[model samples]
Target: MALLVIAACQLMVVLDITIVNIALPHIQSALGFSTTGLAWVVNAYTLTFGGLLLLGGRAGDILGRRRVLVFGVLLFVFASLLGGLAQSSGQLLAARALQGVGGAIASPTALALISTTFGEGPARNRAFGVFAGVSAGGGAIGLLAGGMLVEWLNWRWVLFVNVPIGILIVLATPRWIRESPRHPGHFDLTGALTSTVGMVLLVYGFIRAAQEGWRDPYTLASFAAAVVVLSLFVLVERRSRQPITPLHMFADRNRAGTYGMMLSLSAAIFGMFFFLTLFVQDVLGFSPLAAGFAFLPVSALIAVGAGLASRLLPRFGPKPFLVAGAVLAAGGLGWLTLTDVHSTYAGSILGPMLVFSLGMGMEFVSLTLMALSNVPTRETGAASGLLNATQQVGGSLGLSILVTMFGTAGRSEARQQIPRFLAQATPAERLRFRRTGQLPAPWSDQVLTAGVSAAFVMAAVFTLVAALIAVLVIQVRPSDLARLQGGPDPGPV
Candidate 1:
């Protein structure tokens, strides 16, 4: 029962990362967001959630996990209500940022609770497996749910749907989940604030560059501010009595390498989801429900691949899986770069997605094991929070880079396509084009496909970099391998 409650919280937090992605088009249409601005609909939630995760984890250790979890769930529900009622893009973005705050509080603490609640053995292993499965599969589940809500009800329901689930989790948590013992600690507000602001500025720089070119004054300023703020964050962490992220944790080569690999892979994963959702709907002309259902196979294959990797990991160790997984993921993205306006879901999307999904599943289990291996009991919470933060931050940063690629490619394609579109348009269509300055049908589809393809090429580069890191940087020692394979200290979930 306790596991169910914890898993439910994990599902809600992780799923929120992608569920809103499926509804982005509708959200854009209703809110009057520009193509580039729409990215914030996803980034707003992720940036805040990723930035505050360490603080939230420390809060769980200082206060009880159950207490913080309940508070977080309530805040999340309130944010969802706000998001559903939002009248403008700014209002919606604010609500999404609030949702990320609630999630950042709830997610790490929920994972930490598994460490406290279950004794370290088969029971804990089973519990962690359930949690891992939920985390791995949550994105696809969000897509399906978002599809249903958007098609049947409206885009607002994607945000509103969380209210009921969050309410249930909040109500059930106190009765079923036990409180973790509190530890004495001080919140690193300086470190948290600097890091969050720095990352937001960094992302905004890339977003600005995508819209207004690299030489734009605003883009240059954002990058400058990010560098200064992030340097301050490093200084603050080094000087703090109790840092949110322990600086020395990265000293271990294996752990540092694992974080690097995770960052690269997560960036690729997030970009793939964001762009593909747009590709299927806008270019292929799929309905929202159909687009949602399109990703079901990815969920199934990921779950299967994860199960298989867990079974085989004890025998072969993590390196083989990491290398194989990265290669497969890179290969899959490479294949997806072939997509075009005429491409069908069966021929272009499904096969590559299945391969990519399986690789992601395999990599996830190995990455989790690698992240937690050889860590001390006292600092386990910090380690886990750092890993989760890397994932979220990587997604935000990677998406920004891809969007830049997409924008540059998209503008070039649009220029070439305009003459052709004008040549082929009917009298009424030409008037509409001149009035609104929007391309119709085949021209729009071509431009979109060009941009998406360029983005995937970069996403493939990210996975390939992960593969290189796995091969060159991550060295698996005998002790670490044993620890990964159910040694005395398995580390936290």
Candidate 2:
């Protein structure tokens, strides 16, 4: 029952990440949001969720895990209700951010509860398998659900739908779960503040650069603030009696590699969803429902790979899975980059998506096992919180960076093609294009295509780097395996 509750909470948090994406267009249209403002719907949630995760994890330690879990679910439910009822863009964005705060609190606490409830052998392994399965499957499920809600019902249903799920989980949690005792430690307030603010500023800078150029005053200020704040955060962490992010978490080479791999892999996966959704709806002219259905193959393959990895991980170790998954993902992204205006789904999209899913599925499972494998039982919450935080930060950083790159490349390519387009056009056609303040039709195609391609290339490069790190830095051998399994081998990495 405890595992079930944890899995349910995880599914809710993960599902929220992608579900709103499919509804972005609908929300934009309804709310009359500017192009840049629409991004905040997703960014707001990600920023708060990622920023507060460290604090949330510690909260679970300071307060009872069960208490924090219930409180988070209730908070999430209320935030969802606010989002559902929002009449303005700002209202909705605030609600989403609040929802993220709730998620940050619930996610680590739930994982901590799982570690406390399950024994460290088959029971724990099986529980983790289920947890990992839900985490892997939730993104795809969100896409599907988001599409159905936006197409059949209303976009608000996407937000409203979480209310019942949150209620059910909150009720069941109290009945089934045992509360973890609170620990006595000072919260790392300074570290938490610095880290959260720094990340928000950094992400904001990239997002602003995407819209307003790198030299924009706001963008420059955000970047400067991020650097300063992050520096302070590190300094604070070094001095804190109980740092929110312990420095020793990165002491183990394999664990550090696992964290890095997750960061890159998450960036790649989130970027894929972001750009692919645009390609399907804007370029291919698919309805939200069709686009959602299009992701079915990728989703199914990911589930299969995750299940397979969980079974194999206990035997072959995490290195093989990580390396293989990264290679496969890079290949998949490379294939996706080949897509053009005339490319068919089967030839261009489906095959590559399947390959990408294969890598994503295996990479997530293997990295998850590696991250949590050696964490001390007492620090499981902190470790899982750090893992989740890296993923969130990576996604935000990757998307912002890619968006800026895409915007700049697309704009430059569009400008260069304008002269050629005007030369081939009649004076009246040229006048009409100038009147609209939009790029010439031919140039527009080139720009959008180039932008998407650039994003994919960046994603591929990030995954390739992760692959290299997995192979070079992470050394999980048979002897290490013996230690992990608690045999008569020397303990500790």
Candidate 3:
């Protein structure tokens, strides 16, 4: 029952990442969003969630995990209501950013709760496996749910659906979950503000540079602000007694390597979902529901890989699974680059998606185990928060990089194809193209495919780097294996 509550919270938080993705087209049409601006619908949530995760974790430590969890869920529900009722693009983006704040609070606390609830060994391993599976598969599940809501009702339902689930979790949490002992500490507001603001500026810089080129003044300014703010964050953390982010955690090579692997893998997966969702819907002409179902196999393969890895992890340790998963993920993304305008879903998308999902599933469990296996109980919230932070931050940054590539490639392809399209298109089609600067089918297909293919190529590079990190940096000593098996504490890393 405790695990169920934690998993539910995680699903709601993680699924929000991609659920809105499925509804993006409808939201764009309704809100009159620019092509590039639509990403903020996703980024607004991810950036706040990633940036404030450290603060959220610290809050749990000072308050109590259960108390913070309930507070976070309530905030998330309120934000969902606002998002559902939003009347403009700005309103919706603001609501999404609020939802991220709630998620940042709830997500790390939920993971920390797992440590408090379950004892170490097979029991804890099983709990982590379940949490990891939900985290791994939630994105596809969101797509399916978003499809049903958008097709049967409307896009607003995507945000509205969170209300009921959150209410139930908030009610159930106090009843089933016990609170962690509160430690007296300050909020670290300076550290939180500096880090969160820095990340926002960094992400904005990438997004702006993608749309307006690196020389854009706003992009340069954003990057400069990000550098200065982030440097201040490091300096502040070094001096603070109760820092939100414990810098010493990274001193462990194995843990640091796991964080790096997570960063790279997250970047690849986030880019894959964003681009492929667009490809299936716009290029393939699939209905919203069909596009959602297109990713069903991904959820399944991820489940299979997660289950397999969890069972095998105690035996072979995490390194082999990490290496294998990273390689498979890279291979899958590489295969996706074969997608073309004429390609069919089964021939071009499904096989690679299966391979990629399995690899991702395998990596998630191994990463989770590696991240939390030997951490002290007092710092569980900070440790878990760092892991979640890396995933979200990596996603935001990676998506921006991929979007830049996609836009550049897409524009170049569009320029070449437009003249031919103008000559061949019907008068009505030509008028629409001129009005919207968007080509109609067949012609637009090539442009979309070119951009999608380019994005996948870069995504493949990310996963490959993850694979190399696993091979070169992650080492599980026999003593580490003993700790994983519930042996006595190996003292601080």
lDDT of 3 by residue, 155-261 (tens): 99999999999999999999899999998888888888898889888888877876788899999999999999999999999999888778999999888998999
Query: How does model 3 fare in lDDT?
Result: 0.88
User: How would you order the candidates by lDDT, starting with the best?
Assistant: 1, 3, 2
| Strongest candidate by TM-score | 1
**Which clashing pairs does model 1 show?**
none
List the candidate 1 regions with Cα displacement exceeding 4 Å.
119-122, 477-480, 486-493
lDDT of 2 by residue, 177-218 (tens): 988988887878788778878988987898788778989999
Q: What do the candidate models score in CA lDDT, each in turn?
A: 0.90, 0.84, 0.88
Query: Which residue pairs collide in model 2, if any?
Result: none
Error of 3 at 369 (Å): 2.4
On the 0 to 100 scale, the lDDT of residue 267 in model 3 is 92
Quote the positional error of residue 235 for candidate 2 in Å. Answer: 0.8
lDDT per residue, candidate 1, 87-146, as tens digits?
999999999999999999999889889999999989998999899879877887899999
| For model 2, the run of ten residues with the poorest summed lDDT | 484-493
Using TM-score, rank the candidates from best to worst.
1, 3, 2
In model 1, the worst 10-residue window by lDDT is: 484-493
Evaluate candidate 2 by giving its C-alpha RMSD to the native, one decimal: 3.3
Q: What lDDT does model 1 reach?
A: 0.90
